[model samples]
Target: MTKHTGAWSGTVAKKSRAAFDGSNLYRRLAVRLDDGTTIDVEVGRALWRELEVGDRLVQDEGGTPHRGQSSTA
Candidate 1:
């Protein structure tokens, strides 16, 4: 598998229900990258709860996503 490293900033454009595995629901986020390209990221229910449409997201190269602070000053 290809590993992505470093931090990337983007906006959560949309979300969708990915799968239901017995107890947990897997969710996918469509993030619009800073450059205008979009990427689909699958995350667990816990992480999914923290994300919302239009929220700024910071994803580490390790594929971990976090809620990012606003860039507007």
Candidate 2:
């Protein structure tokens, strides 16, 4: 299995939806990292509900971090 270690912080740029097997809806987000890199991060329904465009995100191997709250200085 692949392990996602540490964490990556970014902002939610957009949301996407896809239907798999004809009826299963999948949600993903386009995150623009602080380094100017963009990546697609797949998320579950619970986390999806908490996320919105422009919201800051931090994710680790365990999954969504800080319950989707934006990081603080």
lDDT of 1 by residue, 1-73 (tens): 2333567889999988843767766688888989998888776788788888998988876668888997887
Error of 2 at 15 (Å): 0.7
Candidate models: Cα lDDT each: 0.80, 0.76
Candidate 1 global lDDT: 0.80
Per-residue C-alpha lDDT of model 2 across residues 1-73, encoded as one tens digit per residue: 1333558888999988888668989888888987999888777888778878999888776666434556676
Q: Which stretches of candidate 1 lie over 4 Å from their true place?
A: 1-6, 20-24
Off by over 4 Å in 2: 1-6, 61-73
